[model samples]
Target chain A: MNWLMVVLGALAGAPLRYLTDRAVQVRHTTVFPWGTFGVNVTACALLGFLTGATTAATVPPALQHLVGPGLCATLSTYSTYSFETLRLAEAGAKFFAAANALVSVLAGLGAAYLAGALATALLG
Target chain B: MTREHPEDDAPAPGPEPKPTGWAAEPADPDTAIDPWPPKPGRPSRTPAREQAAILSVIALGGALGACARYGATLIWPTDPTAFPWTTFWTNVSGCAAMGVLMVLITERFTVHPLVRPFLGTGVLGGFTTFSTATIDTQRLLDGGRLATALLYVSATLAAALAAVWAAAALTRRAVV
Candidate 1:
């Protein structure tokens, strides 16, 4: 049952990342990977909220498996992020490459921090 | 990953000038680091049947990857106060595998388009998560383990990047 929930959530999450990347990349003009940036940060925020909720016992373990490990994990991809950063550097966009890594780490941390705080305040 | 111009695929009403900055190389769709905008001249909309097939494979691959990740955690659960070795190793190893996979598919062998989407975008993408890493750092910080938090964040970042670079470099030397 737990595994099934994870599989089902991933079914939605993985394709969502692909589709979201496709949508976001087309709208942008820069070589910077805004699509991945957007999804990663968003996933962090959602996972943060879910973590806080679980800590407060407002979220069940099953839901945690579905959303945390299944959905957000699939939605947020470190491999793609690293590959894009490497590609950017290889392509001579050194500044964008560094910015992509630095900014992503900072923004993802910030989103997680802020969302966790909000969840704790609301639930705990 | 080359910048893909949207106008390259979708029909345009007017003769708008293509944006400048990044050159759109006609890279093989199977080999692109990022799968967006779908190579330079290929039509964006594939047959509905093909699209469904691609999505199904991606979902199946994602489930396999996620299950493997979950299995790792169950096998090696970490204490909340201790370092998250499971996730750290998962990300590092996944990135390393991605390096090898990318080199093989793009540089060494010609493969079906679905292969990249399944293994690269679905499996490795699902296996290694940026969000969980960030949140793990936040939890450590919230618990007032400042030193461990900082160490975890920087160490994971450095190790993951180094693993990818070294793996790709080694694979390239070994194969090409």
Candidate 2:
């Protein structure tokens, strides 16, 4: 039953990622991979929220499996983010690449913290 | 400053040196050796447009890779307080596979340009994740498994970097 939910969630998450990435590409001309960055940060926040909700007893175990494993896994990315940063640095945009990396890490953590706190307050 | 003569860049005249290996004159005088070796009845060059086509193929491949990652997690659910085995294995296996496939496709087989984007950039990029790894390690630390979490965090980072290096080296060996 939990496995079934995971499959369904992945189905939804994967296509959503693809569509969102495409949309972001159409809207922006920046060389940075904003689509991937946005998705990953959002996913991290969602994971945090879900974790908090589950811990607070507001979300069920099964739902946690679906959203956390299935949806979150499909939504977040790390390899592309790393590879692109390296490419940018190699192409002589070292400062920009380093800033991008730092921002992603720090901002992602902040988003997760906010999401977790929000979920805890609202759900509890 | 006045510019130097173009002929000055050329090598000075010397006694004719004996050729080391193949005696055939290169097709391009600017290059000392043939970059592309002739194969029996095989074409010497690929079309330029093929490189551009790889991006779309990779994006589609990424979707599949992400889905596969979710599937692997489902099969091995980790306890909240314990080490995350599912993510660890997923990353390690993905890294190893990337290494092997890079060699086989880039060197041993005549892989289409589209295939590299699909498999290397899209699929592998999507399959293995570092964000989740970081989050999981932090969670483990927060949950009081400090030693396990530290080990997990360092191992993933070091191993993944090594894996990429190994893959690139293997591909170079097979090609050259």
Candidate 3:
């Protein structure tokens, strides 16, 4: 059951990331990767909510498996983030490269912290 | 393939000439998530059909990669208070693999258009997660382990970047 949930969630999450990336990328002209940044932060917030809910015992473990490991993990990607940073630096956009790495880490962590706090307050 | 004058025939025949760097490469979008920009002179397919095919491959690859990640965690569950070794290694290794794969597809080999979407964007993207890493750090901080959280976050970032850079450099030098 857990395995099936994970597969199903990934089937959804991966396609969603691709679509979101395309939609976001087309709208932006800046060299900064808002598409990947948007998806990663969004996933962090969602996983944060799920984690908090699980800790509060308000959500079932199966649901957590489906959403957390299955959905959020697939939706947010470290490899692409790092690769994009590498590409930026290689392209001589050193400032944007550094900003991309620093901002992404900070924003992702911030979103997770904020959403976790929100879920804990509401559910716990 | 012998050229009468390699300098004159600068446009070597392949998917694209080996990019010396991003400078030599065309000014395509730097983000690898975008589909390979349509090469000139190739027959165009129906846009909807191409998109559906790409999405299907991405879904399939994502499921496989996610399962492998889940299996790794199940096999090596971390203690609640301990660092997330499984996820850390997963991200680093996946980044390393991404480095090598990108060099190959872009420089060394001429792959089918869907290969990059499937392997790079789908499999490696699904395999290494940013959300889990950030949330795990958040959990550590919430538990009053600020030192551990800081170490975890910085170490993962540094190691992931270093791994990708080193992997790509080595792959370029050794393989290409």
Candidate 4:
């Protein structure tokens, strides 16, 4: 695999994560972590497409290193999710905490499924 | 590091004692300071140059973390229908490290502030991912492996949370 692809993708992914996180938080004035949720779904969609295309042999697996594990993983975070969940629980926003987890899982799966199907259709 | 924020060094707005001897052993020393976790978006006392340095460090760590994750996936290239054990373990372990690292830096150690953002935000953040886990589960469910999908999802979530909690608790008990 082209290791540079991983580095290149991360160079883009990490900064994009920071910028997108800041932008999302700036726009939404709520306790809900729209920032992390937004990036998680977006990255999942991209990962799904990458998986579909690579598994189908429509795209070189090397590119998978760049987009799938590199960009998507860096762009999406679990620490922030866990931290936010802990924070919400500590703050007694139990409902919002549950809602955040449920919504993130549901939306992430939905987006990934759709994107994977679309990639199969277009690339495969 | 730049000291451009003269106001920041001129005695913080909060009533915390100055870094006397660079060691804060309060009478209790039992709790993390209130107003803990400096507000996001609030500019740090570090100058723009130092902020840039920390950002670059984060980026460097991100590249290394991503490569490590990619290597793990390559070692065990599972088909889409199978449970992605590689990703699951990667996330669980990463979160566990994060829990320990955060407590060590924030509570136990008095290192540079940038150290947390660099290692925690950069390496551990990049190494662990929630998005790929969700997508993998969706792929399994779409492939009609509902049981496997459910198992993978719940198992990963539970493992990750437990790992973090256990690691954090262990670190605190040892240190404090």
TM-scores of the candidates in the order shown: 0.85, 0.64, 0.87, 0.80
Note each model's CA RMSD in angstroms.
Answer: 6.9, 10.6, 6.8, 8.4
TM-score of predicted model 1? Answer: 0.85
Task: Please tell me the TM-score of chain B in candidate 2 relative to the true structure's chain B.
Answer: 0.62
Each candidate: chain B TM-score: 0.77, 0.62, 0.78, 0.73
Docking class of 2: incorrect
| Correct interface contacts retained, every candidate | 0.65, 0.17, 0.76, 0.56
Grade the docking of candidate 3.
Answer: medium
- For model 3, how big is the iRMS in angstroms? 4.8
Candidate 4 total steric clashes: 0
TM-score of 3: 0.87
Which number leads on TM-score?
Answer: 3
Whole-model lDDT per candidate: 0.80, 0.61, 0.82, 0.72
Report the lDDT tens digits of candidate 2 across residue range B89-145. 777667666656655654467655456556655576567765577578668867899
- Put the candidates in TM-score order, highest first: 3, 1, 4, 2
lDDT of 1 by residue, B1-176 (tens): 46668867778677777532122421112224344455565435567887787778878888888888888888999887888999999999998998888778767787897998899878888888899889888878878989998899888877887887889889989995
Best-fitting candidate, scored by DockQ:
3
Evaluation by TM-score, superior candidate among 1 and 3:
3
Query: Which run of 10 residues does model 4 chain B get worst, by summed lDDT?
Result: B25-34
